[model samples]
Target chain A: MDRLLVVRCPDLLDEDEDGTALRSFVEVVDAVEAYCPWITAVRPGLCSLPARGPARYFGGEDALIRSIVGATSDITPVEVGVADGLFAAVLAARRGLVVPPGGTPDFLAPLPVGILGNPGLAELLARLGIRTLGDFAALPASHVLGRFGADGVTCHRVAGGRSGELAELRQPLARRRVDEQRGGGRPGGAPRRATVVDEPGFWGGVGDTDVRAGRSLAAVQDLLGPDGVVTARLQGGRGPAQRARFVTWNAREPQEDSTLGAPWPGQIPPPAPVVVHPTPLRAELVDARGEPVRVSGRCLLATAPGRLSVEEAPWAEVTAWAGPWPSDERWWSRSRRKSARMQAVAGAEAYLLLVERGRWWVEATYG
Target chain B: MFVASPDRRDVDAPPPGPSPRRSLDRERDLASLAVLAERTRPVSSSQTRLLPVVPPLADLLPDGGLRRGSTVVVTGLAGGGPEGSGGGISVALALLAAASGTGSWCALVGLPGLGAVAAHDLGIDLARSAVVPRPGAAWAEVTAVLIEGVDLVMLCPPFPPRPAMARRLVARARERRSVLVVVPGRAGWPEHPDLHLGVSDMRWDGAGTGEGYLSGRRMTVTATGRRSAARPRHRHLWLPSATGAVAEDATGTGTAG
Candidate 1:
């Protein structure tokens, strides 16, 4: 059995963006392949691909088409039409038909002359009182040849359910993959190993690494595929000496890296994953100058999926004195929230705390 | 006592009627005064109503601007007659421009080769325009659809309509309050129009030696039929400076019915 399927976007003309439509078409085609291996998508403005290989692999033509149709409907709106030739299949699909084999000639015979697309031919055929394909096929070959030349002969052949010359399809090339190494060591004294994968068609692969470091991201991209994402964390260091951890999407574990003052030139390796939001803190402090004062403190917060939050302390005590300085902050617009902060200075250090989601968390300290 | 009696007798004798010439003189004076007043008042000037053409031509046509829902038959001269130079583009533009001014959408029914770009150059916004080609045996059906919604419908027939179809379309236009502008190959149409205008070429000054613009030309617009009689004054007009072509008063002799 021979079967044909036509896939079309009903509102293709009305769509404003071409990229969106192309993406949608690709997704639908991918969905179709999930069930049926015999399916081939017909790209607009290109020659059709032969279904013979897929048809044989899938057992039979009918099962192949049915599987394809079922899978396609799961993702997008699609219609299927089956016929002997591509031309007949497209027309049948447009007219919403599922024609049986050897039925093309009889089916096309009664269609209007206008549907033929050639106005001159339609007018001439109408003048001769020939209204249907059956009538045109019944005429003597020589007479039709005399009237319409080569085109008439071709039309006659097409009407008689004969195949014409088909075009050859070409295959696409394969993709290459690349891997890159991270810093000399791991961050936070944690055991870590990070590798970066940069390859064409590799999507959504940002392993673990602190991406905020000045030049670590640039180093990672240089080492891995030219387009690599790094997520990382920093620990056990102050300011510039802070330890950074990172990972590439393909990497197994986060890699710890260190940047003393500035990042090293050349290929910057990927780092380890650093928690985007840090825990909030509150503290009481005494002034180093020996004056009795109350100070509240706050720190930045981090959350999953790489988001940051800020919270301030509500109250704090300093040098045996306590005071309430409530904090109210909203970062809904910028996706960050922190308001008034209370700081307490105790001896030589200042401690900070934050209240988030109605619970207080130890935030940070400054020495 | 004797002196008083003589005065009373004189008073009774003097009770007499006035002269007949006096009454005649009064009636003659009133008649001449009426005639003088009638002669001094200028003849009542007729009121000119706007004729409905396409929306753009509203300003060009005398008031009574294209009767809403009436048909304007646009006739083109055969061969290269003096009137047929621009094809039908000029008249079509004029109508479309007028319709556009009123914020009305115009549909070109059965005219396939109408150059939308050229139409735009002539100041017809095709963005707000729709063209239906051939329209097949359902031309009337399509026309009815446009007539019901569109402000103006322009039709260039593949074949002249039979009387019945023409009458039906005209009635439909009236019912829908749409102005139907028919571009006719020849002058005659079976049905009479509310106003008939025959357009012919007119002479004008050439473009300025240095200036970029072409000086306006004068056109001989002959207005006939019953509608024209009320405002029968006809004169040459300079094509106005506006891109849509408004008619400006020109130095010409007037012919009034």
Candidate 2:
């Protein structure tokens, strides 16, 4: 009840900081998560893990504290603090000290109110002759409410170093572990290490959007399960949106040296269609005699398409048509997909048809 | 040099003894506090801020620009308009330019054709805009996230949201004070939006023969506000002028009569 383990990684925000720093921090976080199930990320550089469970395993509080410092010493210097609650623990971590048991309130009383993290409240408190946490805690609850409704209640509670939300946070961790068990992973046991990285939304490398293609975005949300919304981050590749991917939901940087970044040896056709199927649909592009139209190796149409029929619909007369544009992509790579795209119109509907692997298919509808 | 502790209620002042003047001062302080709270109440609780659209297309809106926390349903009119056209996207993106220019973020949910290149070309800050082109059944969830963080979120949910889900999203957008542009697709449409925009008289210009390159198009955009008494206002806009940017047709066609 009177111990907290604060993990600190300095140089996290240094201009030269890179993935090395992040990786090291995640390693420290992961190592702690292996022992303690409940953790609160204080900031990018600091995190607080409850020591109640780990202290028993290591035999004592001091033993648990030493283990944490000892575990991360090789990677980089980390400062650890053990105190009554989050407020005192964070303060002690900065000073590299451990407050004695039942002394958190006394330790917090002398500290300035700036530690509460509310700058405007701190400024108002300073102007109200409350310089230290002790002075802040002395103010009448009613007076604080009259001045600053709900917000003042929190500052007053924290200034007194009282145990707050952290006591309730443990319940959720235990619940999640039980929930994890239903997934058929070591059922009914101590839930596996509960790390933030393992959290459903916390980590995403969502790349392809298959469901979005060829159907409504919500049509197949059930298909992707927890990944939920799959967005394409146009990476440093460019053939079409189908191939242009990098994997963050928001990608704006124009990928350099993309395939046919400018016009390659051949002429680049017009801009892409509005809707493109993530997966092309099988279809037939026939000439007047109903024979499948073919594109020669020289990228010329052997026979003009007289009619088009999509798998969803029967033979529709040609309203209008354009293109036979050849798309020879990544021919240098081991896996290459080459296709000829044609923009065709039929009965007020426009379609982007593809001819790949010597078979014709409807790629997307422009309408 | 200090006279009589210039302000008696100052932080450094000694605890006060009972005095009529001090009591009156406290009352005045309470009165001012009440006034300050009234003046600076949280915006969404009472009124919402407005999102400013680009100037050239401003007149097309009932308000001078797009109003925040309100949904604008945009679609192409079947009669007297280019049928099965992509003009709605142009109008929506045009509405986006002003907000994105000033660094406000815009998110596109389940709406495809969010071509980053095209958005950038139309004066949108590509880095600030997030595109969830296919959010699937998570349309409401995805839109909620964007609406919470971004100034404007454009959602083209394939099916009209169920009444319950639509109500929830509408409330969320209003609570967050962000604009939601809903272009409902085949399945259905959301509940009535605050503003309705119909694109009519859309025609491609600048391409005369087989020789000249494709330039831009002109569209008569009409806006009717559901909550306002102002009559529907229409303006002919070059959604993308020859320069590929939205410009109000000041020199071309006149405003709607």
Candidate 3:
């Protein structure tokens, strides 16, 4: 998950028929973008950017947040906060507090379940005596999935602080409104090539396959809606999921300086995993004594890993393993995390596993 | 500064006039240029119409490249579990690398959480590839549509495709002159492909009991197909060598039968 800094203007959240609030929100985005180039307009009045780079540039997160607040205060009263994921970051912005790294779960535990934005689920949980996120997080995942379906499982993960995002947090249509304000012609800019007026077989012209592909992909959009088809663009980040961003195939534009050539200090070496779970899978690692293995505060393993099970599947012997690469990210900021990653080869498969808060999760697979 | 340099330059220079022309006329020159352009096009030859394959995996195909209208099935474990699993996704991705790099468009259907970095490491042109991670119940229809648009389409059916559906897709690929690469993970393909590649015996070379990082992996790839490639051929390869490109595993000898 990304360590994000969210800027929220409470008064500008709702749009007026006269378009007054949206115009002010655009000003807020422009002011924030002056400090950081990667600021994303999550919605009409909310925006976020990865906190690591900007924090490093302007002394620290506190200084950076202060500078942004100072810049945007003229346009609209702005609140800024940094946290691990977008959902927590938004909540942090609301309270004007920075949630410390590896502290999101603790931060979310005391909040009411209604904060999840799903009133129906909250009302149901309220009846079941699960009023707070902490109580909801305590339910066994299997029971949650059986009762709530996939959406429930997702909410369960977010409430437990194991995951950082919820599908309802951002409205894509609102983001498009912000994009249109930035003068990129139409919302997503033009398609990469001029597929409409194609001059096939001529130099510098679109090919026959490209035109055919555009038409077919448009057909898919008709079948599965606009968000169905996507293309991946490479970006610099530590985790596999963070390194790439998937955008609607038609709306994708060439982003500059998104190559892997940029130096990322703590990234895992090459031969990157072929599968990065969008949501990390739960795992249990135990020693021969059947005792759960742990990583100490000093970054040392409690015992040699003997067996491992993912999603409560049958245990497989841990044949070979690598470092518990300590990731002390954003240490300068209050949102610092003390997680570690390891490469474990069990049987015929290899997995990039992450351990945080004494819980293990399968982050990626080298298949 | 020096005025005599003009005469000195003339000693080594040819008289300026109309540029020399070839003895061949304009019509002949145009014909020769046309032949050069046709031969230099990315396709192997006009008759066979083959797409290029990476050098390490060339021998796995009967035509030394992907035939324009052929179906290839790649089988391996699908998901990760406590029991360990190796997906045939890497091989399927490797097949797309060479063709897409040479300006061919490709599409991936029904594979989720694609490790984009790994695809880039294997030399795939991400700009030219379209990925439909979750096609749901419409995976077959999605694959059929992609076959008409892209030069190569890699399909991992989200469900066990019915025999009729699989046959229809295979027939569609044949008719459209597209290369269909299927990574039939758990949802097996019912129709027989022109070429079948299976991945097995995966072993990691580095990282033993909290030691070095993952440097490389050795795996056995068996290729069997119809007609010219009726006999099975086994080859050992580093699916992802230390730098993340396919390479021949020198330690083991391949057996062809």
Q: Which candidate comes out best when scored by DockQ?
A: 3
Off by over 4 Å in 3: A1-206, A251-257, A329-337, B1-48, B77-85, B254-257
Interface RMSD of each: 37.8, 10.9, 6.6
> Cα deviation in Å at residue A160, candidate 2?
24
Tens-place lDDT per residue, model 3, B109-197, is 88777888888899888887888888899788778777776789998888999999999889888988989999887778898899998
lDDT of 1 by residue, A75-187 (tens): 55655555666656666666656677678777766766555555677689889998777777677654654466434544554555553211111111100100011223326
Give the DockQ (C-alpha) for candidate 1: 0.00
DockQ of 2: 0.05
**TM-score against native, each model:** 0.32, 0.52, 0.60
* True contacts recovered per prediction: 0.00, 0.05, 0.67
DockQ of each: 0.00, 0.05, 0.26
TM-score preference between candidates 1 and 3, better one: 3
Q: Candidate 2: where are CA atoms >4 Å away?
A: A1-238, A249-272, A281-297, A302-321, A330-338, A344-352, A362-367, B1-48, B77-86, B112-114, B201-219, B227-230, B235-257
Q: What local distance difference test score does each model get?
A: 0.42, 0.59, 0.78
Per-residue lDDT tens digits of candidate 3, residues A1-367?
6789999999999989988898899889878888877777777789888899999999999999999999988888988989988889999999999988889989999999999998989998999999989999999765774466445656787888766656577655566666566664445543323212223432232354565666556545545666788888899888777788888887224422246688898889889888887778898988889998899988789899998888887787899999898976532226656888889987567889888878888888887
lDDT of 2 by residue, B98-185 (tens): 8767545566777554544445546766545556656666567656555655667887786568988887778777886778887665
Instruction: Rank the candidate models, highest DockQ first.
Output: 3, 2, 1
lDDT of 2 at A353: 67
Q: Indicate which candidate wins on TM-score.
A: 3
